[model samples]
Structure formats: structure tokens, C-alpha cells
Target chain A: MTQQPTAAMLAIGDELLSGRTKDKNIGYLADAMTLAAIELKEVRIVADDQEAIVEAVNALRARYTYVFTSGGIGGTHDDITADSVSAAFGLPCIYNDEAIKRLAENYARRGIEFNESRRRMARMPEGAALIDNPVSTAPGFVIGNVHVMAGVPQVFQAMLANVIPTLQGGVAIISEAIDCPFGEGDIGTELAAIQKAHPHTSIGSYPRFSDKGFNTQLVVRARERALVDAAAIDIRAMIAALQG
Target chain B: MTQQPTAAMLAIGDELLSGRTKDKNIGYLADAMTLAAIELKEVRIVADDQEAIVEAVNALRARYTYVFTSGGIGGTHDDITADSVSAAFGLPCIYNDEAIKRLAENYARRGIEFNESRRRMARMPEGAALIDNPVSTAPGFVIGNVHVMAGVPQVFQAMLANVIPTLQGGVAIISEAIDCPFGEGDIGTELAAIQKAHPHTSIGSYPRFSDKGFNTQLVVRARERALVDAAAIDIRAMIAALQG
Candidate 1:
């Protein structure tokens, strides 16, 4: 069987690192990529430094099938993701005519002046394709495998919606969760044995402790439903044996 | 004044990457680190793969003053963080007597069997010191510059409380927020000029759009209060000019 298309995310901003902002994009992108059958391999959140952004972009782009970046695409001085991405790809960051025209029209309709700073949104790496942004007219861009989108949660999500459908995806990974009455310490041994027995499927045990109670949840995941089911059965039996 | 101690975070687990769990630790840690006067430079989330964990651990540990890791420290099969940390440091992973006895007593008091799988939590790189986990008895460990903590938010926060005081920190970064009536597009030009003028500080303008309304929040951050205040004064004057 062929490997699924893999993705990595670069969240660029000082606001996120300074704890002034909580990240809404990583979880959103992870959930979206999982549903699209594109495996999200890694995610890196870096400050709005061009060197750091360029380094992370180059590293992840070389490894993953696709690299999606969120944040740093606005009109302000800190919005340097587009230029950094261009540097990563060794291309000149340019103000594309199509993007500039679209953005100009959008601003003109709203009676907002399309000033030089506002026009900065139209800058993209040379030979890049635009990703549609329905929420706002400032389009995200795709250069090579890197997709640079907006930092705002709504805009990032909207641009991602337009990007996911275009990517090639493989079989969806299925997951089954069985809640064990006992804790992870109680079932960790047999669970390891079961996971070793079914090498193809991946098993993860999560212990939940809340005001309600404490219980262990065993998650089984695989591309094929049969493999996931097979591992899940052993997990249930392991819990049952502990009860017996 | 000397630079603040820099830190990087590695969030490890398949559950996080698969979107089975939305991470609460990164934001919490970022907030805590910022308050402690330690700069959190970068954060990476990787699956529970040993090679990935080892590589990230080494890379971050090499660059930053401290490397804090969350997740993959439980008793289950997927908990490979302890072993990976040992590999990264080229040390032997062993069950420390102090950690083992502490965990054993905690389980014994709770009338739970301290099985081999439970004892697995005591495994840490050689010459590592234990970080206290008051909520759960399975103590996290600190080896060299890396501090390994639990994945659960409650326990991770608890463990971090114990670890933070031991580290050295510098001057706190002061941030001042000025709420602008206009949007980012309206102020991006003058904002850029202000940011360029105050090259020593970082100025970020975030657009807020909700049922309440649309506004831009301009944040100024610097190690010294005067730099931040001066920048804020410039930012406010610029906004006033825009209104005029």
C-alpha cells in the first residue's frame, strides 16, 4: 500500500509565542487534514523572524508532501510570512497583478483606501497561485508545496477550506476508542502485548481524570477498518480479563 | 541587562497529531514561561515516534537554555519519551531508586498494584533529577537542560510549577495594548513606520472582528518599560493622525 500524503504546519507570529494569543489554527488544520486523509506529521510555531520562518519552512517543505503556514500574512510590518516563504523557496517576493487587482477592488467596494501597507497583502513568491479567501478578499498564496494563509482564525479556516479539496488524498484512517474502567497503569502491560501482537495498527492509551471520574481510553488507528477492529477487540478483551 | 533565558517546547504524542486531542499544554506553558521571564522561542508537536522525539530533543536542547517536553511519559506502549530522551543525550535509561520507591508508595497507598508497567514511569536518563508531580505520583524527570513532564494539562501544570523556580530568569518583558478604533488596513502604514522607528521593540497589530465590532489591538513589547511606553505613545499619536 502507498503512503498517505503528509503535511506540516508552520504557525508564524510573536503574539502566539508571547502567550498574548491562543492558537486556533493548529487544531483546526489537524482536524481538517485528518478528515481529508492527509496525515499531519509535524507542526512548528515560530516567531515572526524571517530567518526562523525561512529555516522552518525549508526543513518542513523538504520532508512533508505539503506545508501549510498560518499567520504573518496581514498588512502590518510583522506580516512577513509571504516574504520569508519566498526566501525559503529562493524566489523573489512580488506583488502579483492579479492579487493586487482583486484586493484593490475589494477595498474600493468597501470605501477603504488600498494604501501601500494594505497592498502588502498582495505580495507573494514569484509564480505562486492564489488561495481563495471568502471572508476577506486578500487571497492566500501557494508557492511550490507551501500554502501561506492568514493569521486570523476565520480567514485561515476559510482559505484552508478552499485548499483541501485540491490536494490528492489516500484512504482515510479509521479510529476506534474503547473506554476502560481501569486506569492506564492497570492495563499498560497487556495493552503493550496487544499492540505488539498487532504491529500494523497503532494503539494509544489516554487517561482521563475529571470531577466526574477517572478512566483509560484506548484508541486504535489504521488505514484499514479490519486492522483497527482487530486491535480494538484485543484491547476490549484485555480490559475484560482485568475485570475477571 | 542580560538576555532572558530562552526555552523551546516539544509536545509529543500520536493523539495530538491525529487531532484526537486538542492540546492545552502549549498555551499554558507559553503563558507560564512568559510570566517567569523566560522567553519561549519555539514549539514543535510531533507524533510518538522515538526518532522524531530524539531529534527534536537534541536540536532544541542544543539551541535553547531549556527544553521542556510534554506527553509520551505515561505507562503505556506509546510512551517512548523517556527512552528517546536518554537516546538524545546518549545516556542509559534506568529506573531510579528514588523515583521507583516514590511511585510504589503512591500506588500502594491507593491499594493499586505497582506492576512492571506502572514501574515503567520511573525510567529516566542516568543522572536525572525528579520533578515533583503532586497530583499524580509518577514524577517527571529533568536530564541536563531538558524537563520531561506529563501530557495531561493538570499534571503538566503541576509539574511545571515545581520546575520553574529552579531555573534562572532575567527581566520581564512588558507589554502594553492600545485599542485602535480603526482596522489594520487603516493603520498598517503608520504602524509600520512606528515599528521601524522603535527597532528595539516588537509592535504587533491584531484585528478583532466579532459581534461586538471590528477594531485593531496594537501591542507593544519590550524588556524596558520606557521603550514600550515610547512606542505606545508613537502608536497612539499615529492612530490620532489617522483619525484627523
Candidate 2:
């Protein structure tokens, strides 16, 4: 891991790709990752296919410090994330006894059937640890660097909250946002020079077009506050000169 | 290439990964792709780095029938999607004469300077065709099967609308949503049986929990209406039987 622990998110589902469910998890996870001092490097939204899930999980887990996946952990036929993740790690998917006990007790209390279908929630890769889901009885599993969580937003959030406390985070990135009166075109060259000067700092320009014409938001980010502030100062100066 | 045209989205920007800017393009494009009779298979959000962009562009372009990219095509330091995409295709990113002409004319009408920075908007891969941008007049370009569009929602929409008409679309996928009174656990086994029975149709179960407890939405999707309808009927029957 670098100064900031890098992470890749795999948001798996068919509904997201089909436009049936607009993903609400990626942004939420991204925000949470930012707060935890994790550098979210990539996000891949793949289908519910086991092959797709396994392939993505293998690729992401190897590349990043942490790989977080949300979706397909339910008690349905399409919920193959656990099995796929197990396959990715070359482990057999098995019914975790602790997970099964919890699910069984919860279902019993709720007067629900603890049948094979519901029991699917207890499935995990062999030797994987569990991330407790307060909202749902089904526990998410952590195998190696990858953490597999629920597709439901509420459950995913709850599991994430549980996972955060256990993490030994890296340096938190500090940032500053400067609103530029001019468009990106007016300051692109100067912005490029500023970026070259601060190689370690990330400077991003966001342009918005409306009735007021184009105005850009310059965001400077770095592991240290002084680095971000310095870049922000340079960006503000560049914008001020361009406004002249 | 299949019955339904397949597409993969490459959302390029560092802001999205950093959680500084929530992505608005993926959902919009997913909806648009659905409407255009195209099946969106995968979505990858990568940073503004040239290497990441190039790698993702190459991977998605080869796998899907069409690869659509949004963001990082702006005239800013972080905006390197055009150059990266050109590199992916082994082509030189050149400033197109027609694009330059349009930008120059638009800027002249608005009494704005057509400076070197603004001229960066005219950059595209050699031998690429242009996609008209009705919003800001910065043209998107198409090289091979990849369509590069703006990051801005309005501009991306306009370019997509323009691109849709030009495409030879595949079979339109039809779908039906059946509201299940029971949770996924209650009907998972029967639903799986139904899904197994219908090989052509895709059956997905989505569960929601509130004060009312768990309720699932079963969506059936296929190339033809009959295939989707058949699976939906089976799902409805399973839900009704479970309810009784």
C-alpha cells in the first residue's frame, strides 16, 4: 500500500447494467472510503454472472490494497457473489457454521423458515471471517484482501460501518476546492504547469455550464494539508491572473 | 453482435474515484442504452491517468460491440481521455480542422478568445468521425467502436441522442417486473426452478426491507417479449403459491 491504502470497488448486479436500478452504493462507498483514508482507485460495475464476478474479484484484489464488492449476497438464484468470490480465491464455498447459527437463530426469532434457500446466506469461502450485518442476519465475508458485502444499500452500509473499525488506515488525504470565475479553457495551460510543479498533489478541474456560462471548480488533493494548500494557492493565483 | 447490441461504459475522471464528484453519467447512459435497444454489459470508472484510461478503453472496446466514454475530454490538465484513447487505438491525437472551425466560429460569435487552451477541445484520434455537441459545440469523436463524449450530463445526452440515430441497433430487449409479496428467502428455491426452466429469460430478484418487512421485485428480461412474459408468469405463480 502507498501512503493512502488503495481500493477498488466491484458493484455487481444485472439490475444496474439494465438501467432498472440506478446504483446508489458506489458513491456512498466512495465517500466512506475517502473518510477512512483509503484511495479508491477504480470502480467496476459488472453483471451477476459468476464468471464475471470471479474475474473482476481476482483482478481487483491483486491490484489494490483492498477490494470491496457490494451485491449478490442474498438468498436468490442470482446471488452468486459468495460462491464466485470463493472460486476467485481457489477455495470451496461452504456453509460457515457461525454464520449459519446466527441466521438460523434470527430466522427462528422472526418465525421465518430456515430452509436451503435462506441458508444460502450462510455460505462463504472456507476460512473467511465475517462482517456483521445489523440490518440483515446474513453476514458478509472477508477473504484475504477482499470484503464481500450485501447488495442492499442498508445492509451494505451497516457492514461497512462494521468493517471500518477493524481497518488500520493509511494517511488521510486533505483537499481544498477553489471556485474559478473562468472556464477550463481560460486556465488549462497554467493549470497544467501547476500540476507539473506539484507532482504528488492531484489537481482536478470541474467545469459547469449554465445561464452564467462556464465556471470551473478546481480541487487540489494531497496526503498532507500543506501540499494541498500550496497547490490551491497556486491555482487561485492562476485563476486570478486569467480573470484579468 | 448478439440479438441485442452490447455496450460498455468507460467513465474517466479522478473526481469520481475520490468521491469529490458523484458520477451522474453512468445511470443516465444506462437508461439511454436501454432505450436505444443496446445492452449495457459493463461499466468501469477509472482515474484521469493516461495509462489507466488507455488500458480500460482497450479492454472494453474489444469485449463489447460499442464502448462509450464520458468525462476527461475537457480542456484541462486532468482531461486526458482523448489522448489516452488515441494511444489505445495506436493513433495520433490531432486537432481536427472541422472541430477547430466550429469552436473558432462559436467563440467568435460569443466574442471569446479561441486560444490554445480552447483549441484542445478540437483534439481527436486521426481518422475519427465527429459526434455533434449541441450544448457547448465541442465535438465528440468516434474511432473504431469507441464513442468519446463529454463528461457534462447535458452534453453527453445530446451526443448520445445524435449517436443513437446513426447506429444499426440489435433486437430490443423487453422486460416485465413482478412484485412479490414474499422475501427472496421465501421463494428463492421455486424462483431458481422457474429460472432454470426458462433458459433464455433472465430472472433477477431484488429484496427491500422496511417496517413492512421484506418484499422482493422480480424482473424478467429477454430478447423477446414472450420469453420475458413466460418467466414472469412462472415467477408470479411461485410468489402466489408461497403467499398462500
> Per-model C-alpha lDDT, please?
0.88, 0.86
True contacts kept of 1: 0.73
Top candidate, metric lDDT? 1
**Which numbered prediction scores highest in DockQ against the true structure?**
2
Q: Ten-residue segment with the worst summed lDDT in candidate 2 chain A? A: A205-214
Cα lDDT of model 2 by residue, A108-182, tens digit? 876777999999989999999999875566899899999999888867876776676566567555667687878
Q: Which residue pairs collide in model 1, if any?
A: none
Please write out the lDDT profile of model 1 over residues B43-134, one tens digit for every residue. 99999999999999998999999999999888888899999999999999999999999988877776788998999999999999999875
Q: What is the per-residue lDDT of model 1 for residues A1-244, given as tens digits with 9 covering 90 to 100?
A: 7888999999999889889899999999999988999999999999999999999999999999999999999888878998999999899999999999999999889899899998999999999999999998899999989999998999999999999988998789888988889878888889989989999898889987643335778899887899998998888788788889
Q: Isolated chain A: TM-score per model?
A: 0.97, 0.69
The TM-score, computed over Cα atoms with residue i paired to residue i, of candidate 2 is: 0.84
